[model samples]
Target: MPGIYLGAILFSLVGMMLIDLKYSLALRVAPVRTTLTVLISTSFFLAWDLVGIATGVFVKGDSPLFVGVTLAPHLPLEEVFFLLFLSYLAVVMVAVFERRAAARRRHGGGRSATHRAPLEESA
Candidate 1:
C-alpha cells in the first residue's frame, strides 16, 4: 500500500494522456504549448505549497500510501507527480472545451437545438 497512491496517480495520468491522444487534444495538438502550460502551472502550485509550508498551513501527514520520499521538509516526491497531473488535466480540459466550442461555431454559431426557437405550425 505504500506506493498505491502514486500508482493510482500515474494510472490516471496515463488514461488522461490516452484521451488526449485519441482526440488529438492538448499534448497531441500542441506539445510545446501544453508542456509549457503544465510546467508553469505546476511551478506556480509548488510555489504556493512552499508558501503554505512556510506559514505552517501545509503539513505532510504520515500515511502508509506514501512512497516515503520528500522533496523538501513537508513536500513529498509524489507531490510533483500529482501537481503535473493536475496541470495537465487542466490543459486537456481546456482543449476539450475549446474544441467543442470551435465545432459548435463551425456548425452554426454554437446554438444547439435546445437553444433554437420553436418552428411555427402550418396553417
Candidate 2:
C-alpha cells in the first residue's frame, strides 16, 4: 500500500484522458489552451498548498499509500501528480460541459419555459 494512492490517482487520470480522447474535449479541440489551463491551475494550487504548509495547516498525514517521497518539508511526490490530474480533469470537464451546452443550444433544446412563447398566452 505504499503507493496505492498514487497508483489510483494515475489510474483515474488515465480514465479521464481516455474520455478526453474519445470526445476530443480538451487536447484535440485546443491543445495549447488545455495545456496552459492545466499548468496554470496546477501551479496556482501548488502555491496554495505551499502557503498552507507554511502556515502549518497542511501537515503530511501518516498514510501508507504515499510513495515516501517529499518535494519539500510536507509536500509529497503524489501531490504533484494529484494536482496535475485535478487540473486536467477540471479542464476536460469544462470542455465537455461546454460542448454539451453548445449542442443543446444548436438543437434548440436549451430554451427554458421563461424563454419560450408562454403557451400562446393561454389562447
lDDT, model 1: 0.92
Best by lDDT: 2
Model 1: residues with Cα > 4 Å off, grouped in runs? 110-123
Give the per-residue lDDT of model 2 (tens digit) for 57-105. 9999889889999999999999999999999999998987898999998
Task: Note each model's CA RMSD in angstroms.
Answer: 3.6, 3.3
Instruction: Report the lDDT tens digits of candidate 1 across residue range 37-93.
Output: 999999999999999999999999999999999999999988999999999999999
Error of 2 at 121 (Å): 11
Count of clashes in candidate 2: 0
TM-score of each: 0.88, 0.87
Q: What is the lDDT of candidate 2?
A: 0.92
**How high is the CA lDDT of each candidate model?**
0.92, 0.92
